[model samples]
Target: MFVQEIAPLAGSLGLSALVAVLPLATVLVLLGVVRMKAHHAALLGLLVALVVAIAVYGMPIGQAISSGFQGAAFGLFPIMWIVVNALWIYRITVRTGHFDVLRRSFGKVSDDPRMQALLIAFCFGALMEALAGFGAPVAISSVMLVALGFTPVRAAVVSLVANTAPVAFGAMGTPVVTLAQVSGIPLNTVSAIVGRQTPILAVFVPLLLVIIVDGRRGVRETWQPALVCGLTFGVVQFAASNFVSAQLADIGAALAGAAALVLMPATRKPAREEVRAAVLTGVATEQLERPEDRGEVLRAYLPYLLIIVIFSIGQIPPVKKLLDAATWNFHWPGLHVAGSSGKPVSGNTFSLPFLNTGGTLVLIAGILTVLALHVSARDAVREWGATIHELRFAILTVAGVLALAYVMNLSGQTTTIGYLIAGAGAGLAFLSPLLGWFGVAVSGSDTSANALFGALQVTAAHQAGLSAELLASSNSSGGVLGKMISPQNLSIACAAAMLPGEEGTLLRKVLPWSLGLLLLMCLIVVGQSTILSGMLP
Candidate 1:
């Protein structure tokens, strides 16, 4: 058995880390520089990861291949599954023309585009994120915005930006749960800390939404509703994440905000009697379209509802056991390499059975959508067939990114990167959020980021004489911003918006904002650690 050594690589961690970054670089270059599409970039990046895993990391070929395959399967399933089903729901809505009604429903709320953005992108999207995170917010909301008359680019950018605030608690607070597990910290303590830090973000995100939509005046004009939305979301997010289930935080906050919007009158528009008359008539006309038939819209919504139900059920303890029982776990044969630490470091693989995985549920959703739409079985088969070719590149890209991430994690390259950054000491406080950003960028989930680096942050903070809780929480809070730039995210957004070649363009637009948010989060961490010591749990 080959042993892993940390000390020998300590001196060269920086270089090794750079070597580990090659796959990511290859992906960006192929997509952004060469103008290649996501699929091609993904495949190339995957190939690069395979090489690096075997050569640079000294991983056994068999183990490396197995690791790659396992990660690819994960990428295709739950992560990609969420995206596919979400888009399918949207398509069903469009196919049935319910989206037009959905759009009109929003118009009834407010005619101002900025408010619409805040309501749809910020508030409604958060609920979607909370329910089914893996890119659900972007995939669902961006399309909703596009349908509501926002330009496709604006929809994509806005949805990406708006997705940031609730991500730490996404997938039912799975990130913090993972962090707690990895760090051996109390789950409530981890949840509370992350909760505290993230609400600061929730407060500003609604304002940011308005600012992005129509600048400072727009924000100022709508500041009341924005404040109400932000405060409600922030307060509920803080309370729910700490006191209740973390997964319910975003969903509860979002629902509250949306309810407030529905109840609150729009302050921007003066009611015109004629326009009022038209609206009243419109409502009557809409109601007359047959209440029974309109219920079909709700029926069209069932697949998504089922997805949430199934995913949630799968997460329950008893159900988790059943689901896990079907999972295939195997020791990797060849990838273990001896490191200076004298530990066996290698790849592993796990495959949950189709009946138990989120993907299986999503595929079931797709089938239900076909039946609900009354589309022929042959047409449904053809639709899925068509979906495969269209999604080929997206699938390739996500798989590649996941493989690179897995390689970095299994080969100790990620630790090398973490060590280098942590060596910055107390100055690392200002960089804590960026660490989360980098982790999320690599792993594509804030939860994954927390799992990857929560322990590292704690270790680094202790070494640097900083508060470990504050720094660890900063990782979760700050990582939310990176949600927008993650390749998995970009792929999901593009797939949802049907903007395949525009992922880079979408990335470029949101990249600056993501960094800006991270910087803000870092400052918050510094303050919480130094000036406000009692702020963290």
Candidate 2:
């Protein structure tokens, strides 16, 4: 039987931890500094992890390889599965011209540009994150802002900042799901903890967006709607994630935030010169006409509504039990490994959630959406194919990243780092979020960061006498802030804003926001671990 040892190099935890960091370091340096392609960097990191697992950690070579395969399977099945179907659902909307209808509806929310930032950047961006994360929200929202007459740099910057609040629940809750899967925590527990943490940011991001869009003048005049949107989003996100389904958290918050704006007190429009200054393209914000028919707006919104309704119904006890009955659970072959307790580690087993998996639920939602939207069967198939094609490289990166994670984890590399970091005792609570933030900054994905460090957070939390759920959820909450600074995201946002080769400018603009928010999240997590413990679920 293969066994894991926290410190296998001269029995020194520090030295082993130092060695264990190589695979992660390899991935980060290549992505962040070398600017290597993501898939290539991920594969190289997997190679480093395998070498460390077998040579440094003394793991069995066969089991190491087997462990990597197991992780790749999980990545492909549930993680990427959820992302693909969610994107497919979005593509179906795009293919049928409903997305433009929805876009115009948002663009016409208010004549003032500040309200548009709240609606499009904060609210609609959250909806995009919920459906097709991994930088799609930043790209789409930034481009939409430019289309609506905002400066390209401002569009990219505010979109990056506003995209932070919903990231923990992005891509149909894949990031939190990955955190739960890797940490051995229950999905609901992770979701509930994250729901509490990120919503705090939700209450502030709308305000930040208004300030960015129009400076002090924007806030002075538009703070009412910003407060209403942010407050509604925060409350609904908290309620839905805790009491309702985590998968529907962002969707609920997005719709609620938008509704709050629609029902809010009216505000005066910006001056023409102000619009011209922001737009620079000479396009007037009020020129884009809203759809005249309320019926069309209802149709544009039905797919998201259908998702919430269907997923919520699936959460009913009887239906949940029936759906879960089809899941397959089995121990993985060629992956027998013992933890510190001298018992087989349970993570070596794999679960196939079948009808209960997020992918399946989203598939059900997509089918309903196709019917309601009147998308032809042929076009639906085409959208699915287009989604697979678009996500091909992303699929490779995710699978490789997961393989790297499992190799590091199963061979004790992560445990070594965990034990080392746990040496900080209570201080680990304050430092935990930085680990996730740094990971995401380099890797450009909250899901990837969670996969790499979720188990480590749990291990460190146990050793540091902190709550595993707190640190685990803190990882994601902190990582959301890092999304703005990720090189990949900067590139995507710049390209979308038509600010090609201006990534440096965009990076400088958003870096402070990312760091400032990260500090806030760090403080929040520290408090949650101590005096603010009541905040947790």
Candidate 3:
């Protein structure tokens, strides 16, 4: 078997590291600078990775190709599978006209645009993130914002920004779970550290959403409610992830935030008659015109409610054991090359827990949704087909990026890059989050980001005399910010907004927020490594 070499550029660490970054740089330049479509950029990035694996790393051509196929297969299963089913559930609601009732119900809570944004984009979006989370929150929430009369660009931006805080625990805490598994860290420790980090961001995200929605005036008017919502979310997120099951962290936080919003007294100052008249003439009229059918509203929300129930049930120890008992575990074919450490490189076996996976739970939710909504099987089939068609580009983008990541890992390119970064010593704390940001920006999933950088973060922390749990969790927390800028997520948001070629526009809108939050995460992580080291669980 061919062995992987960490420093393949004439055994030079710096040279090998530089070469290792080429695929990532190619993707960033093509998507961010050249404004290429995400699928095309991903394809080109994968090609670069393949070439580097063979030429630079001396990976066998057959092994490299097999690695790509393996990654692609994984992407299609648990990742794309969750996305497709979640969107299909959404399509069922839209087709049954129940989604309008849900929108109207939210509209009833607050007519102010800023308040509406807080409810839909921040609160409800977090709920979706908790439940489905593979671009589903951005996809569904952006469209819902538009239906509430937001401009498509604004809708996309709000959804993307709001998606950040809940992501580490999203998809029933998949990112943290992945971090625990990959880094050999205790799951609760990872969850608790992430809890500490992301909850801090949760406290500010609603305020950020208001600023994006209605500018300074929005914050000026809605600061009280925004503070209430953010604090509630942050506190509950911290408590639940630390004290309760990490798997239910986002669900608990989301419920608390939404409840806080609903229970808090309306703090919106009344507008003058003239200003109110002008607002009414615009989208406010559409908002005011929505009919409220309590039953219809309940039905509109039933799918999501059922999703929470089903997912929570699946998380129970006995149920999980039963469901996972039939898992399929096997080593991948043609990927048995050894790494520089003289161990098998990419032939680790994966266990496919078909029934217990989040994707399967989501699919079950969709089936329950069809039954509850009384949707005809024929119509359900059509909607499922449509959902798949709409996600065709996203499927390609996710698969290609995953393939690139696997090849980098198998060829030892990732190890070279990791070692170079870890050489920063104490300074690595500040750069840790950026590493995660880069990972999620490329792979488009916080779970994928954790898989890519989680172990690396732990190794770096050990070398730097820092807290491994802190840095590993930081990888996940920092990755949440990158979601707003991820090309795959951007494409999904754009598609949901029905703006096919506006990916660049959406990226430009969200880039500043992404960087700003990422910087905040860096500071938090740096503090955790030094002055705030005791804060780690």
Q: Which residue pairs clash within candidate 2?
A: none
Q: Per-residue lDDT for 78 in model 1?
A: 56
lDDT of 3 by residue, 329-413 (tens): 8888777778677877424555577887777888898999999999999999999999999889878987887777777777777
Candidates 2 and 3 compared: the better one by lDDT is 2
lDDT of 1 by residue, 1-537 (tens): 434333223357667767766776776677555767656766787788778767876767776776676656656655566545545555555666765566455545676667778888888788667655767788878776766556677778889999988888775565675566445577788788888888888888888877766677666677888878888888888888787656567767887777776566663464444433422221122222334455765765565466556655666788778767877655644445444457553344344455665456566766776777677777665555665665666566666666655655565555555566667887898988888888677556786567556766765676677777777878888889888987778888888777887878998988988888788888888888788767766
lDDT (10s digit) by residue, model 2, range 1-537: 887898899989989999999999999989988999999999999999999999998998899999999989988988889888888988887787777777777766666777777888888899889877888899888877877777788889989999899999998888998899888899899999998889989888988888787888778877888888999999999998898877889989998998888787653354466654653442434346644577777887888777777778888999999999999999998989999778888777999999887788888989998998888899898899999999999999999999999998889899889888898999888888898999899889999999999999999999888898999989998999899989889999988888889989988988888888888899999899889899987
Q: Which portions of model 2 show Cα errors greater than 4 Å?
A: 267-287, 290-295
Compared to the true structure, candidate 1 yields what TM-score? 0.75
Model 2, residue 412: distance off in Å is: 0.9
Return the top candidate by lDDT. 2
